[model samples]
Target: MPVNMAEDGNVAPGLSAPIGGKKIFFVRHGKTEWNNQLRYQGATDIPLNAEGRLQARRAALRFSLAKVDAVISSPLSRAYETAEEIASFHKGAAVEKTSLLTEVDFGEWEGRTVAEIRENYAEIFEAWRVNQLNVDAPGGEKADDLYERCGELSKLLLARPERSIVVVGHGAMLRALFPRLLALPRVSYFWRTRIDNCSITAFGADAGRFVLLFQNDTTHLKVAEGRIASLPLL
Candidate 1:
């Protein structure tokens, strides 16, 4: 059996080699009022703004060209709808949703603004800013809990050797996800990584261990950074 190292994104320390398995793309759901406002958007279920819809459309255009096998998304309306848009653009694709992929549940602070969170729960908010796995949000899940939830489910998907899939979900979730792609360290989630709206990233697994191939590259978004001159050299 291959070890599930995606919790830390590690390579050799935890056994590294392609187990003839593959991982697919991880895309953050498009922006929303809360996202643009920098609010604690955990499980609030806000729909995409006009900007977000356009962003998803751009992702759809790109998806139409790429070859993806399936698409998964958070069960929230925003993510579910966004996944549907991408699914429609693809050839008879299915957009599936599951609780495992949902955004972090904020409990009492679900729809509140960041400023409100800071004002009402300053210390707790501070801990979150630093990415504490032990600190629960008001009444919601902390990083580690959500990680294991999404982590195990995602790994199950990667266990299959076939199927190039896409996952549409929230930023905080993706933040937790990126660092764990190869099962490195939980603390690595906050190493200045950013997952933008409708961005695309891909990874591969050696045996049960995973390896990151691409990360947050939305060049298909028609953004200035997507062009050839903007990409970095390997």
Candidate 2:
């Protein structure tokens, strides 16, 4: 069983700190061509589109006022580029790439649109929607595998020296990891949670306990008008 760190309306005790807890700002990578097309891009390295770059710039402006100590990102180009934008605003803050932050592998589903998947793999899609934890994308990574990776990521983040940092990653991976971080059930994965491109989520650690301060905040991108594309469900 996965470790439960959070409870209903209460924070869990985890992620130890020497002096005090750290603040982690989690940001989904900027929009990609696949995102605009409503395609599953798991483990598919796609670069940010023009709108994505603009969104990253807006995010950078928002974080410019923040005391960001470091910027960490998935090895994928979209995530790495977004991290670069955030790091640009913070002097001496370099972007660190980690494979642990990569998107969940989609296997046969990679690069396929929702419509395509539904038309061909309707039953599989339904199975995934009903209980993603027990389903796999043909040959992709399973929910349990993702959960384990998320745990690894939690440990990696907790082991970081920086108190304030930014993490850029994919939608599916973030959604999968959120339950573990907040002590929610794996069955609740992706439930009522929407991770838009360049959206910001905040968390703080206190004496090893992780507290979710906010989730999927896009106030910074509101000024971008329609340039911010609609996020597709992958």
Tens digit of per-residue lDDT, candidate 1, span 95-169: 877788888888888877878888899998788777655567878886668778757775766675555677888
Best by TM-score: 2
Supply candidate 2's per-residue lDDT for 146.
80
Residue 142 CA displacement from its true place in model 2, Å:
2.2
Candidate 2: segments with Cα more than 4 A from true spot? 1-20, 224-234
TM-score of candidate 2 against the unseen true structure: 0.85
lDDT of each candidate versus the true structure: 0.73, 0.82
TM-score of each predicted structure versus truth = 0.81, 0.85
For residues 29-141, write the lDDT of model 2, one tens digit per residue. 89988999999999999999999998888788778767789999999999999999889979999999999899989899999999999998999888887767678888899
Model 2, CA-based lDDT: 0.82
| Residue-pair clashes per candidate | 15, 4
